[model samples]
Target chain A: MNESDLPSFLLDGEEIPFTPGQTVIQAALTAGHYIPHLCYHPEFVPHGSCKVCTVKANGRPAAACTLPAQAGLAVESDTDELNDLRRTLVQMLFAEGNHFCPSCEKSGNCMLQALGYDLGVMTAGFRHFFPDRPVDASHPDILLDFNRCIFCKLCVRASEEVDGKGVFSLTGRGIMRHLIVSAESGRLADTDIALTDKALEVCPVGVILRKHVGFAVPIGRRRYDERPISAQALDDAPRMMEPKHG
Target chain B: MAEGRIRVATASLAGCFGCHMSLLDIDERLFELLEKIEFDRTPLTDIKHCGPCDIGIIEGGCCNAENVEVLREFRRNCKILVALGACAVTGGLPAQRNHLDLGACLSEVYLTEPGLVNGQIPNDPELPLPLDQVHPLHEVVKVDYFVPGCPPSADAIWKILADLVAGRTPRLGHGQIQYD
Candidate 1:
């Protein structure tokens, strides 16, 4: 079939063409439209956990990442109502964790930080939960600051599918839900996972960080600082997912 | 809706006074700002107590008894209250201690450090008692606006002030609104 003949859907009044079986987020991104997301990485299967990518599909709320793109479907993202909801989600994530961006190693490069900026989140809308979580610096090559996890499960999916290590998992339920390593000792060093594992790079927040290279990029010169996340949203997924040895 | 100069007051509760430094970073612009607004009880004026003011710009989170008292007073006295910077907006760095037990934290710092000889938690009557959890200014009192950088860029602070002076709702642009 001709590319022009491909079925298209309306996203915020712009017609976005999609191949068969493509999700709304994928189709929108392919057409250079940005949908704010954290859990729906292109390389990994859509987890639909983070509702940051929520869009109104025919007046009903749905996760764009998981929703299949149907022809003539009216999807409402980029609206004030949706953006405001996204901002609230980002704020809740900030309040739920110890996300002190200034002190975090992932300050500029973090997706959550960039989304917060894109959505114009000025404050943590809810009271800070200030949960007491563990930090695992046992791994020789990586550090896991569990306090910053938003429980997106990108790492969990990446480890299980791509790395074949099953190195990460989520345990508990509701507010009690948290990320855990697969080792009996509950430490990254105890797992067979390596620095090169996709799991190490999939964290959207500062939860997983490579040691000795924290602030290599200066504040103003870092990713999302140079350009707002909206301008670079489509490229960010693959760019971030691609492994860099250095 | 005053006829003349808008009165502005500023206070630093548990902050490092960096936000005030950023405000002063307005530098020569301060002269221009002074034409439209008059200082009420800021450190620049060295006034100890706040009077009824048009704008109260507060820096820092509520980390002690005095901070809460001062924040409530600012809310009571000022028509508009601006939470200025990460400390005032999100309890900033000092709030990193929110996870730790307050007693243990004080003990670890004052009683159990390696190099300390007779370090004791200061108990002077002049010192304000520390609250168990550091709270953002909004948690203590209603805040009208928030300029939420670590210390919002001098330009950001100036823009907010200028907008308020011109009777406009301050809307920070993409690059202007940052948390860190």
Candidate 2:
């Protein structure tokens, strides 16, 4: 059924064509309501762990990632509850991973760090999990420290999708479910991967690492770990490559 | 206190120039240190056969006969030997290939008929022959201090240099110190 031909609903006050089964958040986004997300990539089925993109759908809190677009559905994306959830999620990510923002090469510019500050998550109440992960500095140009993993399966997906190499695989169970090598040994650097693994670029946290470049850029010019308006928005930006006239 | 005119040497073996590039991340700070310390041998400064020095910084992991010789020479000359990066400390990325069979690796990198190379690796006398396995610096000789990280963070390099300049013992001997 043509969405333009169907009855439209006011999503964030934007007249969006009503779909039969989609949720308010999804319909709102199809109507151009942008929400920042980490664990929600358009290409893959979302993990929905990082709740940076949670929006108020008809006054009810819901993950915009998994929510489908539906008719006559209202979305309160700018509400307090959605903002609070986003903040909390960003804070959880920072304390969960081995994110030493001051020293990280990706510091001043990490998506998680930027989102946390954007959501005003300054005073954290969660206990920091200071796990000791053995640094897999085995590859000549890459590194992996599991303690820093945020369970964003970007690397796993990247290895399989773009690289066409199933170098990474998520294993274990529950919170223990994290990325490991695809091979039986589950060793990262020893898994015959390359320096520019898609896993390296897909990482939102400093878990999967690379060699050669650190502290090279001056501290003054590095990406600040605050106010993730641009980075997060770009992730969900409408594909320019798609045919708008189609 | 004189802080003692500290001497330092830098060398690489069985690895790419990534580690060296990391050391250069110190930028002008490295040249700034030259005013205080004495430089003995480094790929950047002195290229001829290396001479004895006080603090020897090995950048890469050991993978050949020459690597062994270099490690020994540094151990013999420098009063304090520092493993300045992950490669030197816990075997970094080079050691990953250690998991592979020697013959397989050799064939893949060199002697394979369908290899990328049009010819076999040259049997030239000057080339430092590749070894069967790559080992960390500590495996070959006793290292006095260790600075971990793919390539030791510039802050780490600065801290160690500052410690030595202040006549205090550089604290890289125990526990892992990763600057992110």
Candidate 3:
């Protein structure tokens, strides 16, 4: 079978070729199509919790990251209606957390902040929850600012799968849900997690931060600030090179 | 004084007047803007009250009763109200206090400080009572447009005003639409 014979899906009217097991987002990324997403890192199994990548597939809302692409599936994305939904979700995320972009150390590189800019979120749109979450600086190398967490759970999965350490986990339910360190002392220092753990790098927001190296990159020159997340997504996309049939 | 110049008024409530300073950062372009608009109750004019105006630019969150009163008055007087900065748009830095108990905050600042000998929370009839949470301008009154930045860049403010003066809807592009 030739690469041209691979199953293809319609993404905003463009044909995106996909391997049998590839998700819509993976296929789209492989085809150089950028889909807005969080909590859908290619390195990990798609959690589909963020829902920023919600797109219409066959007239039904689906998380593009988790939805497996099938031939002839018409996906509607980059449309006014879908983008408006994404904008509202991003705004709710902003309001749910105490995201003060101006003062935050992760201002430029933050995915939530970048998504806010990409989605044209002018205001939080909803009344700010202003939850009083404490900053955990118990670890000498890491700083956990709970106020900026968006419940993406990337850190949780990264710690568990990549680092082979279940140092992070979520507790509670719905509005009260929280990320907790796996330690009796309830502190990052008490856990066996090291500074080299992949979990520290997986957080999309400022919740997990490397101490002393913050603000090292100037505001205008940081990852998302240099190029909007849309462009950055394409730049960082994993290529699915044409598979040759033996 | 011009026959058809747009009447423009600005206010700084629970704000650092950084947005006004950014407006002044328009530098020599101020002359060009002045040709098409007249100040009514801005820091530039030092006028105590807002009058009927074509546009009202507010820069700050409503943190107290006086802020709410002033904002309502501005909304009543101006046909178009612009929320000009992060504070006006999203309650900004002042909204940080929303998580803390207001009474505890008052006590911490006044009565419990180490240097204070006999300090008490100032309770005067003239001082406006503070609200529990600082609210964005739109929460209190309808806002026609928003220029969202810490103190939106001078160019951003200029573009909005120029667009308005030219009968165009103000639009801030990607680089101009900054939160910081």
lDDT agreement with native, every candidate: 0.88, 0.65, 0.89
Looking at candidate 3, what is the lDDT of residue B92?
91
**How does candidate 2 score on lDDT?**
0.65
DockQ of candidates 1 onward, in order? 0.75, 0.03, 0.64
lDDT of 1 by residue, B22-135 (tens): 999989999999889988888888999999999999999999999999898899999999999999988999999998999999999999999999999999999999999999
Per-prediction TM-score, chain A only?
A: 0.94, 0.80, 0.96
Choose the strongest candidate by DockQ: 1
lDDT ranking, high to low: 3, 1, 2
* Shift in Å, residue A245, candidate 1: 25
Model 2 regions lying over 4 Å from their true place: A1-9, A16-32, A220-227, A230-232, A239-246, B1-180
Model 3 alpha-carbon miss at residue B89, Å:
1.7
Model 1 pairs in collision: none
Kindly report which residue stretches of model 3 are placed more than 4 angstroms away from their true locations once superposed. Answer: A242-246
DockQ of candidate 2, scored on C-alphas against the true complex (2 decimals): 0.03
Q: Please list, in the order the candidates appear, how each scores on TM-score for chain B only.
A: 0.96, 0.83, 0.98
The DockQ-based order of candidates, best leading, equals: 1, 3, 2
Q: Return the interface RMSD of the candidates, in order shown, one decimal each.
A: 1.0, 13.3, 1.3
Q: lDDT by residue for model 3 over A1-246, one digit each (tens)?
A: 466889898999999888888889988987899999988887888899989999999999999998988999999999999999999999899888888888888988888888887887778767778889989999998999999998888999999988999999999999999999999999999998888999998899999999999889887778877788898898888875542121
Provide the clash count, candidate 2: 11
True lDDT of residue A57, candidate 2: 71
